[model samples]
Target: MYKYDQYDQALVDARVDEFRDQVARRLAGEITEDQFKPLRLMNGLYLQLHAYMLRVAIPYGTLSSPQLRMLAHISRKYDRDYAHFTTRQNIQYNWIKLEQAPDLMADLASVEMHAIQTSGNCIRNISSDQFAGAAADEVADPRPYAELLRQWSSFHPEFSFLPRKFKIAVTASDTDRAAIQLHDIGLQLVRKDGQLGFRVLVGGGMGRTPMIGHWVREFIPVSQYLTYCEAILRVYNRYGRRDNIYKARIKILVHELGAEEFTRQVEAEFAAMSDLGLDAPQAEVDRIAAQFADPEYDAGAPDTLDRSDPDFAVWVDQNVHAHKHAGYAIATISLKPPRGIPGDASSAQMDLIADLAERYSFGELRVTHSQNLVLAHVRKADLYALWQALAEADLATPNLDLVTDIIACPGLDYCTLANARSIPVAQKIAARFESDLARQRDIGELKIKVSGCINACGHHHAGHIGILGVDRKGEESYQLSLGGSGAEDASLAKILGPGFNKAGVVDAVEKIIERYRSVRSGPDERFLDTYRRLGDAPFKEAVYG
Candidate 1:
């Protein structure tokens, strides 16, 4: 994990002081709601339906034990007893008091964390693969580059306010675990001819209009990525729509201007900025990379697991992944319990996780983009003990990418913009399939993502099976889409057909699963593969008939 330097500490401390005054002004009636809206938003505070919501940034989803403990303390002392892990790999507190927000910000600053740029027009928290350092297949760890981008974009004078909010994701493997293709700017770190660079994709996003990014450049030398990224942002800022919020996204601009023209303009900008020295110097790059170097491993650590307990074995098979280190494995702590909220973790659970991370994985934890937690380098020999602790707390669900592990946003239950409730729907769907582990495993890697509305905070457009809530004639209705993925082979999901009521949608999902089972080539064939093979006709027929 990267520790804050003197400069980082000063920046965060100054921001906390600044926001403290802003909050005091709002509470004292010196500023009206309209006047305080942008000010509070800049500090990652939102006035929700019932109360204020605060989203704290976990840059590149990395957290130290003290940081995790701080989050647990925040939940216990300030907001509710639990917090929700979001699809952005950040954590949110639903119930917050405006009076106590400054105190909370001060607590976060103690741990080198803050809510800055978490919810605004500026680039949000930079995200990357949760399994970045541990994943066996990645060419290199992507966190160093992600951190560089975070430092570059934070409170940037030129990009403080864009036409709309922008997001960026970085990954270093063929598998796109970070969903980079669905971001405003996606960087895939690749090794070309023994030299490191990035395969850059630009103008990708999801909302009312979902799109996979266009490949802006085949490969950008690692040294020039900062310059190239500046060029892209400049192009978007220059021509992106300002009149309509709906049409303000860079994706919309890219669509209207066409990829070729966007590329031409970006190229011109990049060429112009070449001599300005926008890219970070080699010394700074090494300083960042050194912090991410691999942890010391026991050379003689055993590499085998005992399968004496079938239940423990099942959990291992489902939740544990191969690590880059031979003696260790990456373990995903599933937040989606049977019929429980998808990403809610209580203060007690957070504290226990922090302790476990320290004891098992060198005091480090990684938050998954899918709303789970990862102990990146757990020793294989200690797997059973970790499993036992997690199982006791109802944390070991053994459904990593299965149907029960659904990714859903807090819909009408919390979000004021929602037309329908998402939590109940997600619960019902998970409960419907959660009882049958065999069925869930049989269904294979089915990502069911739900959003309360089209804002796509839940990333519904990227799921293998997607559900979107809408208000139909003053009633809550659900629309279903299929065949979407936020992977290396990224594609936007297409709507299957007409919408359904809450009950009807759950039933419709079951029917679609049954139909997929009947049509798929074998048990090994994933729902996504089956959908791509047979298209929407069979699934639609299954639901309507």
Candidate 2:
């Protein structure tokens, strides 16, 4: 995990002081609600339907045990006793008081975390593969570059206010766990001919309009990526639409100006940037990289796991992933419990995770984009003990990529932008399938994502089965889409016909699962595979009929 240096600490402290004044002004009636809106938003504070929501950034989803414990304390002390982990790998506290927000910000600053850029038009928290450092097949750890970008983008003068919010993600793996293709800028760290660089993609995003980013540059050397990023943003700032909020995103601009033309303009901009010296010197990136160095591993640590216990074995099989080290495994803690809220972790749960991270993972954990937590370096020999601890707290649910592990956003229940409630539908689907554990397991590697609206906060556009809540006249209606994925093979899901009522949505999902089971070549063929092979016709017919 990257620790904040003096500069980082000073910047955050200054922000806290500045925000404290802002909050005081608002509370003292020196600034009205209208005046405080942008100020609050810039600090990652949102006035929700019921209360203020504070989104705290967990940079690239990496957290120290102390940071995790602080988050737990915040949830327990200030708001409700839980927090929601988001698709962007950030955490949200839904019941915040405006007056106490500055105190919360100060508390976060104490732990070297903040809500800065988690919201607003500036570059959001730079995200990457949660398995970045541990994944077996990755070319290199991507978080170093992600952290570099984070440092570069934080309060960047030129990009402080873009036409729309921007997102950037990095990954070094062929498996694409970070969903880079759906970001505003996706960087695939690559090494070619002994030179390390990135295969860059731009313009990908999801909202009302979902898009897979187009290839902007085949390669940008690591030494020049920052300059290239500046060039891309400069091109976007110059021509991206400002009149219509809907057309303000760079993705919309890229679509309007053809990808080839956009690339040409960016290249021209890049050529002009060499004289500006925008690229960081090698030493700076080296400094950041050193912070992400691998933890100490016992060379003689046991590689074997005793899976004699079927229940423990099931968890190990489902949640544990291959680590780069032979003796260590990456264990995913499923936040999706039976019929429970998808991403909400109680304070106790957070504390337990922190303790587990300390005991089994060098005091560190990674938050997956799918709303799960990962103990990235757990020893294989301690698997059973870890499983037992997690199970006791109801954290060990053996559904990693299964149908029951649903991803859902804070829909109408919390988000003011939502037309429908997303939590109930997710709960319904999980509960429905969890009834028959074997049947659920039979429908393997299925991802069900639900969003309260078209904002796609839950990444509905990237699910094997996607559900979007919409306002139908005056009632909540759920729309379904099938065959989308956020993995290496990225594609937007296609809608399956008419919207359904809450009850009907579960039935519709059940019908699709049955259709996939009936049509798949074998159990190895996933729900996504079945949908892609056969298309939506069979699933659509099964649902609408």
**Residue 145 displacement in candidate 2 (angstroms):** 0.6
Per-residue lDDT of candidate 2, residues 335-364 (tens digit): 998867998999999999999999999999
TM-score of each: 0.99, 0.99
Clash pairs detected, candidate 1? none
lDDT of each: 0.94, 0.93
lDDT tens digits, residues 306-341, model 1? 989999999999999999988899999999998689
Q: Any runs in candidate 2 off by more than 4 Å, and if so which?
A: none
Q: Provide the RMSD of all predictions against the true structure, rounded to 1 decimal.
A: 0.8, 0.8
